[model samples]
Target chain A: MVMRGLVCLLICLNVVGVCHDVSAGMYDEEEGAFETVSALNSDHRFWDDVRLTLSHVYAYGTSESGAIANRSSLRYEFDTTFFKRFSLRLDGRSSLYWKQDHQAGVDDTNALAQNDLRECYIQAGFDAVSFKAGKQVVVWGETDGDVINDVISPRDEREFVFTNLEDARLGQPMVSMDLYSPWGDVFVFVTLDPKVNETPAPGTRYFRGPAGIRVENEKPDTSDQESGIKWKKIFHQFDLSVMAARLRQNTGVLVYDHSDTYKKKYPSYWFYGMGARYATGSLLFTLDASLKRHYQLQTVDISGRYAGSECLMTDNALGVEYDAGGRYTLNAELTHRHIVNDQDDLAGVKQDTDGLFIQYRRLFLNDTLTCQYRFYHQFQEGHTIHNGELDYLFSDHIRVIMDYTFFRERNQRSYYWTYRNDDRISCEIRYYF
Target chain B: MKKTALICLIMVAFASAAAAGQAREIMEKVDNRNDGQTVIAHVSLTTFRYMTQNGKTRAMEQARIKRMTFVKKDEGPREKDHKSVSILREPKSEQGIGFLQYDYEEVGKETDQWMYLSALGKVKRIVAGNDNEPKTGSYFGSEFNYEDMEAYNLDDFTYTLLGPETYRDTDCWVIEAVPVLRKAKKSNYSRQILWIDKDRDMILKAVLFNRNGKKTKIIMSGNIETLDGILVPRKIVVDNVESRRRTVLLYETIVLNRPVDDEFLRVRTLTDKGYRERKLQEFKDLK
Candidate 1:
């Protein structure tokens, strides 16, 4: 039950304007700024390189005419090294709220706050090899926003695709090793504990489960261990990487027992993926493909009985990015997915799907303000989503981001049909210290 | 009579070629100066938009400050071939952000770059960025573009001696450089005029012109100090003519010839936070 996905955009310019004044007060004139820093740089202090951030987000629902969310978050991050080879990182965050409004039927306790240990790792390097162990997030993909090969960590899908992938990712415990070589770099990882995605829980928007159906989880224990390996090489004008992993499914496959309950299970599967990127002039091309064996898929019959299907899943994407020199940038991606062994009598979901995603961005006012428009269309389901956002950097330590999203669906059987009315606006402010 | 005329033509050609060679020799000497093999420094950049009043430039009240730690090491004897990494220390929003670059001098060899985005918690390989836009083609929103920060490739331009003049009470040689065709396509400046302190073999001032032959930026380097028997500029300022913005770069604490591990320049520097910090702390401890 989280509203982080529907990052509604609101124009709280007045509030940011006030914060700007306060920030200015804390900032001094340029004449003596560096002069003061010169003395400080000579000394080491406890908070010298430590970082803390304060953020607030407010969202309003247009379709439901209600307050979707009002929350504040504090984040602490610090990293240090000692003994030449040993290093540690401690990063954590806490989400809370004050003077908040709760939407009807929304579990305020669960929906408002979503906090985590974003990343905390200690690594030791020895010449050509390094080992890191802790809670960490690893990204291994060429496509943006879409997951093809970047599936090492579970994602928070409570808000569906509305939230940015960066914000949705959840770091898990793992021990990774890297071997740097002249030919290429090799990476290996073993998950200490496997976890599943955070889906929409009860009393939250986009929850399509049967009314008041009891939910249960069948989690993986120590015996269901998973591991992965990757090889990356950089060429003259391009880079390529290939990886394979035996990982548990991130999505929970629901199983109904004919009783008033549904058991969610994450089955283990084999995943193989490859990614490559090429850059020439101002244009860059990226490609990623992944194949999953024995992927679990679920379907519900008209009688409300759920059945599980094990099929081979293949996902491919090609993306292109062009920057007309910092003033404007354009990115477009094409995706194709197939359930090779899908059942012909399957209901609701399709066996194959194709999608097109494009985003355009521009900068203004000495690059302090940015405007972006992102759109994605599902060709098979005829589902579409448009998101527009403005990010303003008031200062080095303060940023305000406002965004609005609109979702449209033509096929009721499509998953997007459930969020067709989730269009809304939101405003967020972040201050770093 | 025809033989005499031929002799004069040959003499003129030899003189002209020698003059051109002399200019290149001077630039080569400047490039070959022993600044340092390894450098570690704390850098501060203060920037602000300014307005011209009564033939004088006055800085506006609003100024932005950015602090970072710059580490660079020369790869070998080749020119413009080195590895550099900069880690942001201030602007808490961007703290711990690191940029790593490997500049190569081989023809047709592109520079390799990577960035560690703390917010995303990943290391991302970057492309040759900001080739066209002058407004956003800057280093950390400063007046110094990547080109300005880069070491000049002697082969990229043709140099002409513009005679000597006394600047700031020091004897300096004025030189004009026009970019070659291949470099012009990727360069924002069409020509550059540099004031070099011939004796010290250092750059004192530079005025750069845009592709349209309009003077776009004025750069001045001063506060030279000798550290570890190498001349270093402690303060440098850049003034943008078109945008009326200026940025001042000051080295708060700098040390030269610091023994840096070879592995520190690898991609791991951008990805491994603790290792980077640990390796840097030893150097940072030195005043």
Candidate 2:
């Protein structure tokens, strides 16, 4: 009778679970594996045991284009176990942005705030089968540079190392289904809004683009699907994964014009791509190439803005990473995008652009300290630019970062324009419990 | 002053209640367990790593031991009085002979530890303590402390009977124990809740909590054996919750009141390597 009562009491507490991570190390006296699987956090004493964390960061930078920007963000996270085979967590972030208006030309220093419900998920286990669903981060690929399934949400890209989501394309408030077996794992996601709006052509306008650059309209009814599969073992250590996705727009028409007010109606924003990744211990390799076909407005008879062009574009990316014990890690990657059409050169400029990135980091002071250097170069024949960044982790929780970006252009007269540069200096502190 | 006095009184009342419950439970169980002979057993130790420095790490294997001894209490001095010795070998065998000697002391808590290095040709004293903190700190880096293997002392901690429960198959009284010293923080458990068998006063299972109030380790006792009417646990298993690690102790033999000589337990006997060799040789020669 006593044991039965105790078990019932534990079950009741599990239903109305309360979890508060004590301020102690993971090796607590009551050390049992913590697991979670329910939407309601219950059975805390039996399964809930983990740390909670909060962080904040602020940064300022001036670009060669004379654009000065400042940004800050605050983030909070809660993770805990519920029941013996379930776990759940929530992460939230809010950011503020401000800019200086006068440096080179356009001046707008309005501060803006943006926040998204990042991830809220629960995991469950039944015999050998387990499932996790809700808003969650789907991380795939073996390279930091070319991620495939990382498409949960867009991140701030202006900073050197923005704590943003990688595959911003796929994680669009979607419901995901996962299946696991001894041989491999597979998962699929369904999104409400599938198509991602593309950048407006220069000298053209959009109705719904951010900053009123485009006419804002309700997202078209299009089914967005993304999924991936992974094989458990390849030569005992190697892991392999493949992923793909597609989205079609069924919304209102988009129009582009040539008189700096040109408009075009887009029937759909459709893209499909496949990616592959492999990893072995400290070494990782990734390759992702996708073809994109989009509608573009062209000047008809050199006068009207209604002439249209359907351009076929291809993007290729390759990334490699090597971790040399605890001493250093080196990563190198390149991305090339090409528009396959006679009009690839639009208005006397090549539309094809290529980008390169290389980064090296060293962990000294027994991993208590670290230093990193990164280089980025983007090119489109006449317009070539390079950016450099250096960061040092002064301690386990503190970091100092520096970035310099250089821009250069060549005129028809073969004269090189004055070099334009941007730089930023910042420091941040982080702690976990 | 009135509030302080009230708070002090409340604390005193709670402590007294806790003590009364513990004493009542202990008395009920140990009333029939007086003046019983205790027996030591020879056993091999094995442990499986469920946790490592890195997460989800594990390793497993067997250990090596050179010798083991049995000790007991009696009314009068016999041939085997006060003589106890055990040579523990290194877990991973190396090129030559490498072992440690556990020299038992009579009527005291201290146990002398001397390690023999084949290259040195001498026995080196590695540890000397009253079988308390030092012995309990480490034993071949396994989870079991020396105190955990010895007799339980009431003075080591304050115990309170929370209630009763069934542990494995035994009906037991649930007791909560709080260590007395500040340094006890480094022990496997910050606090312990044990389910002691109501009939034999043997702990059937103990749930250890971390300083953070989380359950971290579980120790279960099994395979009871009786020697001169004293019940003893012949096997024990310790499980680390977070690391998924486990260590099991199984004894192969148990003996009590065996024939042993006093001279064999002397300090000189421990130091004389030739004497040890000659004694073993004489035993072999007798057979």
Candidate 3:
């Protein structure tokens, strides 16, 4: 009942947002003149390069309790450019859920399955400066399938990593400006309201803790603000960038208040990061490093006990990509993270962690079909995730995709081991116009 | 006999000097005719792939459209640098895709290329084996590759006057260009033969040979039109002899020496549709 109310509220908000934008459009003098000129002089219209895509996805998987679950979703995206210098985009999705048995303790139906507004943004550009305002996503970093320095935006972890990382990213309401110059491109962003990553709710199948354990979420006030700046430049065969930001961390740690209850607290922190890429011949090398001050996280012990802690953390990653031939590519990356100035025992807390990622892709049939495999492993915990996908484009506007993912852990007490039994296979078809 | 030998030596020396002078003069004319400070063109490309099925010939076609902007500047007395951006506009799947290139005429320097993938909304730097290697899949699966689109650098190849001939009713100077040792290691073609129009100072046709001395590709340029004091080919066709595939590029509009802002060449323009379209509008009417 509560989820349905939220859905209805979002619908009403969307309607109001559309009406406001349409009313605001009438006051833009420059855009109006530009549209008139375009219509009079050329075949070009104010609305150009409009694109729409419809997609359907289906997945069948078994939970840890041996209950079979089926999930289906329909998604749509609409994008169009207007007045030569402005664009508007929208995306939404609806889904259906089913389970073989209601006795498995998981809900057989989801009331909020059809409620999602993925992205809505308006973009405009001038001679040297460009602006984008509304709900949008800004991505930073070069490594594939790994998060080392990409911390600017929040993410949705409700479905875990099964969804494409790009798709799982939730847009934040922000206004951003990019100033282009020969020396470098500088970006400034101001977010109106801070947003944290959304993890699975307490009653969902993906929830990690024991059932009946109450989970309390403590979010920052809507008035809280966040901002960031990034400067990127390209010199000869090298690309480099540096960024600094003050924002609340997307993922919060859980603190066990007592035996049967936990509290999730989101804390704000400062992050400084730098990244570089150099290309030579068919090989490209990348490096990224970031330092976070006053990082807060929860650590889990072997006995499932959780404790909260705060410390400074440093993360560094190096990656390389090689094109073997016309149809094959290989990529690998190594990341190391360490906690600084740690004074507590924090037995379950990950004071140090190292991870390696490898990926291989091959294309066939004039690049109409692509097959890819990716593997990620954490050194200390012996946790590994393997993913493979095959994508085929049947035509210019239609594509089919199939993917499988598996998670494993050598240490049964590790955090990743909690999902070892939830491997899944999914297929999707997309039509673009 | 001694007098005769001296005379022969003098004649041979004169011929060698004349050949070298002629080659340099022809290259200078070719360069002068094609060089421009800035150029923008809107083009339509059609690719045809032929196959023999059941002893009958079959053909398949693919079409693409793009707008290209090029800028060249003299960096030094002997050095030239160029930057070009090509944005794809047709074939909905490839719409908004873009390629940016930086080429330097200095020896031992490699060209740089970056590709903007619209689907990913990201710009990726392309690193090939050499300047001659294709940046992507044969320039949209056509017979032409990325290297084929680059303007020729006189210093990279040694030219020989193959003599005068008439091709398609036009008087032409046949020239053969062989890559220098340093360039041969990076080049895909062992030698290229050009049919330069004697009057227009443009290459009318070209034949490329592989390292094994086998014919690999042939390109023909036609429908020459003078625009802004420069001869521009309205139509260009490239045929791959090995695969029996061909690509034809038709220039719908050609604008030379147009004012192009430096901001239009930045990475942001490639990723931002509005920025790219706005910049392109500056030259859209050239057609």
Candidate 4:
């Protein structure tokens, strides 16, 4: 559909010479170069432009769970512009995952292959107003290092190689509208997914899905529509955002357990977040507070009617981040999670974690030489996970990266399913045209 | 009735004379003009800037500049000059020199300018009266524009001579010049009053008013010296009224048509870095 539309716009522009306004002054020393190449010089009508991109990625990692994996992905993107107001883009990615058997006794899959649509959207804009419908990535933060790709749901980026989470879905069909005003902007989005299927474990479900339960029959009685509204405003040098959402199904819970003691069944989950960001000169600061209700604890099978089903759980997090000079950044966060139900076989639970992260970077010799160091210490319950990374930029677009991960604590063995000390190193070269 | 009319006429004549006297002092003393066949000078400037916030003064070294100019005939119903300068720092950095030539086509009517920059190695001709593009633009770190050098017509302004006064021991006329064009280009001042020495018509001091009628800039010219029989001010001081900013220019040497070869302004000379270095050394070694 996007390709056809682009072609039609080009044909119309060729019939009319009205598209010059869009390219005027785009080239400082020349006039009509773009028009001469385009078919729109005779009559005045519309304008159009087309661009394409190709990218590839590779990654390798060893998990304490006795699994070694290698992953690769390739992506293609095409963008079309028309009338300087209409834009349509199509993007897709294909991935391959390979894993080695663990030293510990365990049966693991060798390799996996997957393909998914990243973005396929038809968008139109007039001055300050724009509309986009279809599958697209929703980005919300401003800082590149700590904020750029931090939130939102499309697919679990490593789902293909990460067997335990391989079923995680990527894109969803949605309609989004953005309004731009001088003072600020507002965005509204609504997503519809009628074909509901099997639910995943609690704490592991998708953004709008109920804790691991298809609940197809229950959805009809509830609000199955998913919609959210966000308002963003600039105050002084800070950018502030307030967002709210309503979902027909419980979105935050995964697996639920009910003991034979009580015959009870209920939906698990709710999600909410509010954040503020400030950037001045070389300093950046951000604060985020989020809440999750009826969080998943441990689920038990009921004795009678609810025998085959499980319960859901939730948690809350208050986070803050500070970055100095764009070279180094630090983040501190606290989270409190609780299980909703109480039964003879199921008990309420609460877990709290505090984390601190720091990183430093420097570029010398006219940016021809570079170095970086990062450290993160996360304390949960009685356990701590410390991670560090160092990188060097050898050229304008090439870099060598090395990372180290360590886990320490008296209860470390029981804290995480897989905890270990490891080191990794890689080199990459990037080019843009 | 006739007696009263005679008295009124006498009062008007006195008021006019006083006003003219003030205007004459501002121009004739501080800003001395209309003298000599041609005068040239090389000037270097050193600026010290200070700002006061919360009852504390913070001072710092701001900028340095070097310039050369040649003032010529303004008596033959025309005003023209041969001027050139080499900027040594940020505002108007040029690896080489820039030349400026001005010619008054007709009295009170028009003027023309031809500027040649060694970097471009070509001369650009610009119309006169529109000094906005050349003078009002940023030059080096200090604020000085082409318009800042021109002798604007006094008739275009409404003058109020503030009585005869001796400024720095120079008897002067203090007159104000207000623009008739409300939207004149490159003018940040709403009103400007100058103090001119009565003896030489040289401007000595000036006070600039902003759009809000508040004082914005205070300027003083000093170090009176005669070069080639023409009295010239050797030093200039500018103080930003609203800012803790100030600039000072000191003339290093003054000469009248000391003789410059046309070869120095040629395009080939600009491309020859070796020649430029040699020429610069020779200019410095001049007696």
Error of 3 at B100 (Å): 1.8
> Against the true structure, whose DockQ is highest?
1
lDDT per model vs. reference = 0.77, 0.45, 0.71, 0.44
Best by TM-score: 1
lDDT of 4 by residue, B1-287 (tens): 99999999999999887776656545534333644443434444434356656644344432333333232333343333332424231112232344343333233343333344432333332323222312233233353434455545544455667667877767876677776562233355678887777777777788888766899777777657676567766666666657546555554555554445444433223322333334443444321
Model 1, span A1-433: residue lDDT tens: 2234322321243234223221121122322222222343456566755787777777777876777657777788877666788877778888774334342236434334556887888888777888999988888887884778988889988766656776888888899999988788899999969777888767666577766777688868876577999999878668899999999888877788557888887888899999998876567889999999988788776776775667788999999988675458799999998888745646555788899999999887666788999999989999999999999977776788998988889989777787888888988887766
Off by over 4 Å in 1: A1-42, A98-115, A301-304, B1-21, B52-57, B76-79, B129-136, B259-261
For each candidate, the DockQ is 0.35, 0.01, 0.21, 0.02
Native-interface RMSD of candidate 2: 24.7
**Residue range B1-287, candidate 3, lDDT tens digits:** 99999999999988877886797799789887654577777665655565556654344533223223333333335436777787776544466678887777776566788888766566888775544443434675557776587657888788888899998788999998888876676666889999999988888889998777899888888767788777777767776778776566666566777877666666776788777767767777775
Cα TM-score per model: 0.88, 0.44, 0.83, 0.42
What are the runs in model 3 whose C-alpha is more than 4 Å off?
Answer: A1-42, A45-47, A60-86, A91-115, A201-205, A222-224, A257-259, A300-305, A324-327, A343-345, B1-21, B52-58, B61-79, B128-137
Per-residue CA lDDT of candidate 4, range A161-195, in tens? 12211123344567888776655678788767422
Ranking by lDDT: 1, 3, 2, 4
Could you say which candidate leads in lDDT?
A: 1
Alpha-carbon runs more than 4 Å astray in model 4: A1-67, A98-112, A141-170, A194-223, A248-270, A279-283, A293-348, A361-378, A390-401, A409-415, A421-433, B1-287
TM-score of 1: 0.88
Chain A TM-score for candidate 1 is 0.87
Better of 1 and 4 by TM-score: 1
- Give candidate 1's total backbone clashes: 5
lDDT of 4 at A186: 82
